[model samples]
Target: MTVALMWEARAVTGRGEELLAWARAQELTPGPMRRETFRAPQDRVLVITWWDADYDAVLPELPDPGGELVSRAAHRWRFEPVPDPT
Candidate 1:
């Protein structure tokens, strides 16, 4: 099964771009199969990574971008896709 890891953060006022850039530059060990990033209003950045692993497998997460770039700690979640029936 493949698992999707979602990481998100809300940057401090006027630091959205910096936070986004920092997120974009991160390198995860044992890299995922694919990754996508998004920006939302209220200075939010979201990153989704797809990995070829079981839902309960441990995976590397994005590191903190530091207090200077964000208002609070980041948030993360893991998801496994529903099985396909044919």
Candidate 2:
């Protein structure tokens, strides 16, 4: 099965660039099949990683950038793609 992990964070005021750089620099051991990063209006950063594994399989995820770097704890979610009816 394929699993996609989503991680999102809001950086502290004025530190969006730093946070973005930090997130981009992170590396996951064994890594994912694909990974992407994004930013949004409230200085928020988002990362998504695709992996080949079971829904409940343990996988590497990005760690928090700590209180100083963000406004609060980062958010994470997992998903499995649904086949399109065509």
Candidate 3:
């Protein structure tokens, strides 16, 4: 099975670029199959990482960027692809 982990954060005012750079600089040990980063209004940053593992498997994830860089703690979620109904 494949699992996708979502990590989202909102940077402090006027520090969106810094937060993006920080998030991009983080390296995951043994890296995920695929990783993507994005930004949105309100200085929100979102990162999604795909891994080939069970839904409950332990996988590497990005750590907190500290309180100074963000408005609040990051938000994370996990998802799996829907199976074909055939």
Candidate 4:
């Protein structure tokens, strides 16, 4: 099974681009099978990483860019794909 890790953060006012750049520069240790990033309207950045591991596995996450870049602490979540019935 594969697991997906999601990390999200909201940048401080007028600092969205800086935060996005910081997130884009991060390299996950051990790496992941796939990864992508997205931006929302309100200076929010979201990153999703896919890994060939179990849900309980310890995975490398994006570290804090800096206190000045983000408005608050980052949020993280782990998920496993639902099996197909076919």
Candidate 5:
């Protein structure tokens, strides 16, 4: 089923840029078909996600056992097609 991944993470100040760079650099493998980021009033979240070629098709590429100061919060939402708004 077509779906989207929503992930949020927090790190020390300056870590945001570092994380973003790392994420972009991961294109050496099963890279993200696309990704984006946003900032909130009181939180910094890294929104790493991509198109679903079968959500499970990319599970193995995920980090196993997390990383130092790199925590993750992920949720999946299925797509709901809508008629053209034209």
Candidate 6:
């Protein structure tokens, strides 16, 4: 099933530019569905939404990019699929 993964994580100060540069490099590949940045009150955070052909396809590497931030971060929320209301 085609699954969409939405992710948000705290970003390292002064490293935002570096991070974007890295992300640009990865754009050459065909994966990331969408990326967005926002301000968390005073902290700058990045949020991303990606869809995969299979749920498991994107599950494996999530920890490497997400759980391994410079300091530590938390996943605020997650959603899968919900049946439409008739």
Which candidate number has the best TM-score? 2
TM-score versus the correct structure, for each prediction: 0.93, 0.97, 0.95, 0.94, 0.46, 0.45
Q: Scored by CA lDDT, what does every candidate get?
A: 0.94, 0.96, 0.96, 0.92, 0.48, 0.45
TM-score, cand. 6 vs. native? 0.45
Tens digits of per-residue lDDT for model 5, 16-56: 66555554444425545656655443234445556646645
Candidate 5 lDDT score relative to the true structure: 0.48
**Cα lDDT tens digits for candidate 2, 1-86:** 99999999999999999999999999999999999999998899999999999999999999999799999999999999999999
- Pairs of residues at least 3 apart in sequence or in different chains that clash in candidate 1: none
For residues 1-86, could you state the per-residue lDDT of candidate 4 as single tens digits? 89999999999988998888999999988999999999998899999999999889888999877998999999999999998899
Segments of candidate 5 deviating more than 4 angstroms: 39-43, 54-67, 71-86
Identify the candidate with maximal lDDT: 2
CA RMSD of each candidate after superposition: 1.4, 0.6, 1.1, 1.1, 4.3, 4.6
- Using TM-score as the measure, name the better of candidate 1 and candidate 6: 1
Per-residue lDDT of 1-86 in model 3, one digit per residue for the tens? 89999999999998999999999999998899999999998999999999999999999899999899999999999999998899
What is the Å distance of residue 11 in model 3 from its true position?
A: 0.2
Better of 1 and 5 by TM-score: 1
Give the lowest summed-lDDT range of ten residues in model 2: 60-69
Clash-forming residue pairs, model 3: none
Q: lDDT, candidate 5, residue 68?
A: 53
Model 5 Cα displacement at 19 (Å)?
2.3
Higher-lDDT candidate of 2 and 5: 2
